[model samples]
Structures are given as C-alpha cells and as structure tokens.
Target: MRAKIVFASMTGNDEDMAEILEEDLLDAGLDVDTSDVSFTDASDYLDSDLCVLVTYTYGEGAMTDELVDFYEQLKQLDLSGKYFAVMGSGDKTYKEHYCENVFDFEKAFLACGAKELIAPLTVENAPTDEDIDRIDQAAEELANKLNG
Candidate 1:
C-alpha cells in the first residue's frame, strides 16, 4: 500500500503531526510520500492507496492561504476508490472555529468521492502523548483497511 500526506503549517504543529503519522504508516509497511501543501498538487494522490491532509486553521476558521488552492482543487477531483484521512492543529480558545480547517478538508475529500478511513483529528496547539497515540492508532486502522 501507499500513502500521500500533504500538509500546511504556520507554527509547525501540523507539520509535526504529519511527520508522526508518516512514521507510523511507514512502520506499517506502506510506502509513504509527504510534502508541504504549497508544493504538492492535490491530484498527486491519485496513484496512492491512501490520502492524508494535515493543516492548521488560520485566523478564526479561515483556510491558510497556502492551502486554499489545494483544498479547492481537491474538491474538484475524482477520488472514487480512494481512502482518506484529515488531521490538524488549532487553538481551542477559538472555540467554534477550532480545527475548522480540518473539517473543511474532510468535506472536500468526501465531495470528491473518497471514503474516509477515520474520523478527522483535531489537536489543541500541539499534540500531547495521548494525541500522538490517537494518530498512531489512526495509521494502524488505515493500514488494516488497506491490507485487509
């Protein structure tokens, strides 16, 4: 199996989550490709068995500028048989908007016909040990679905 992780990080929190998930997926024996959202094309995941997005919510629930294009493009793609997951970092103080970007991406992927492999993950600022364990568990679930 193969996985592609595309992420956007302003404070590096989202990037860290992406890295952690990547390591977990690699350990599960899947080939993984990861890149910053700005440099990656949403269509690039077409060849992969799994698609993942990790991003940080920007200013009160807005998508980060660098991720806007990718998100839009992703919504327009056809990922009918693909499996996807989304995760992100946000400040919980934002209350209603916390991790909103992650949810937005999840919706976009669903609109493109991709099946969700797991629930979207949202972390406050940075991930704690428990959060990391959740991320690891997500990877394990994805691997199981792909290899089942």
Candidate 2:
C-alpha cells in the first residue's frame, strides 16, 4: 500500500516520532514517504491511498503554524475519500490542552472527507517504547486495511 506521512514538530520530539513510524511502516511492507508540513502540500497528500499526520501541540493549546496552514488548506480542499490516521506528540505537563495538534489534524481530515481507521494517538513528551509500539500497531492496521 502507498501512504504519506506528514508532520509538524517542535523540540525535535514529533520529528523523532514521525521517523520511527515511517521506518516501521516501511519495514512492514508499505510504500511510505515522509515530509515535514512546510515541505508538503495537504491537497497532494489526498492523492495517496493512506495519509498519516504527526504533529505536536504547544503553548497552552496552540497548534503550530505549519499545522494550522495545513489544516486550513486541507479542510478547504476536496479529499473525497482519503484515508487518514493521526499521531500527536505533546507534554502532559502543558496543562489543560494536550495533543491539540493531533486532534486538530483529525478534525480537519474528517472535514475534508478522509476516513479514519483509528483514533489519534497522543504521545507525551519523550514517549516510551510502548508509545512507539502503539504507533507500529496503528501503521500495521493501516496497511492491512488498505492492502486487504
């Protein structure tokens, strides 16, 4: 299956999460590609069979600029039937609003007509191996759903 993974990161945490998921998905037999939000176009991502979004929230529930732009563009575009899964990186210490970036992406993807095969996974700052494993499971499910 072909898939695109897009991410918006701060403190290098989300980027690390994206890299791990990308590698795991490839090892699981998928045609996967990764790019940062600034270098990717959400409308273009709609062309992929499956799209995974990884981002982190910061500053009292503020979504990153890249994510905001992508979400705005994606919500306005006609995805029609793109399949999507979301993973968010955040610090639980941030209080009140954690993982807003992942939630934001999920809402936008649905608004643009993408279907979700699983709920968003929000990884706390410096996620554990179990967090990575969960992401692996999510990717596997995504591949199975698309390939089967």
Candidate 3:
C-alpha cells in the first residue's frame, strides 16, 4: 500500500515524531512518502491510500502559516476512500488548546470524506519512550489496515 506523511513543526519535535513513524511504516513494507506541510501539494494526499498529518499546535489552537494554506487546500478536495491518521506534539500547559492542530487536521480530513484509521496521538513537548511505543503501535495499526 502507499502512504503519505505530511508534517508541520516548530522546534523539530513534530518532525522527529514523523520520522519515527515513517521508519516504522517503511519497515512494515509499505511504500511511504513524507513531506513538510509547507511543501506538499494537495494532490499528494489524494493520490495516497493512507495520509497522516503530524503537526504542532501554534498559539491558541491556530495552525502555522504554512499549515493554514495546506489545510485550506485540503478543504477544496474530495478525498473519498482515503484513510488518515493524525499525530502531533504540544505542551500540556495550554490546557484548552493542547494538540488542537491534530484534531483540526482530523476534522478537515473527515469533512472531505476521508476515514480515520486511528485515534489521534499527541505528545507533550517531546516524545518519551512511551510516546515512541505509541507511535509504533499506530504504525502497526496502519500497516494492518494497508495489508488488509
């Protein structure tokens, strides 16, 4: 199966998480492509069987400038039959807005007729071994979905 991973990061935490997930997915023997949200074309998402978003919440649940454009592009597409997952990094100190970008991406995908393959995954500030384990589990689940 084919997959695409798109990410937006501040301070590299979100990108790191994406890399780990990419490796896990690659090892599962699926063809995977990854890009930063700023640089990806909307068609890249539509062409893939699985699309995953990895991003960090900007101030007060806002997406970054790049992701704002990416999200708007996503709103214009009809992604029927696509499968998606969301993972991200955020600080828990922002009680009301922590990892809100992940949910925003999930909502965008659903609005465009994409199905979610897994619950959103969020890490506080940075990932720990526990967080990596969770990411691995998510990758395994995605692999299962692709294989099935």
How accurate locally, in lDDT, is each candidate?
0.92, 0.82, 0.91
Best by lDDT: 1
Query: Which residue ranges in model 2 land beyond 4 Å of their true spot?
Result: none
lDDT tens digits, residues 16-121, model 3?
9999999999999989999988889777887799989999997688777898899899989999998999999888888989999899889999999999999999
lDDT of 2: 0.82
Give the winner by TM-score: 1 or 2. 1
Superposed Cα deviation of residue 133, candidate 3 (Å): 0.5
Q: What's model 3's lDDT at 69?
A: 91
Compared with the true structure, the alpha-carbon lDDT of candidate 3 equals: 0.91
Evaluated at residue 105, the lDDT of candidate 2 is 78
Candidate 1's displacement at residue 139, Å, is: 0.9
lDDT of 2 by residue, 41-104 (tens): 8777856878888888886787667767887888887766778899978777777678876887
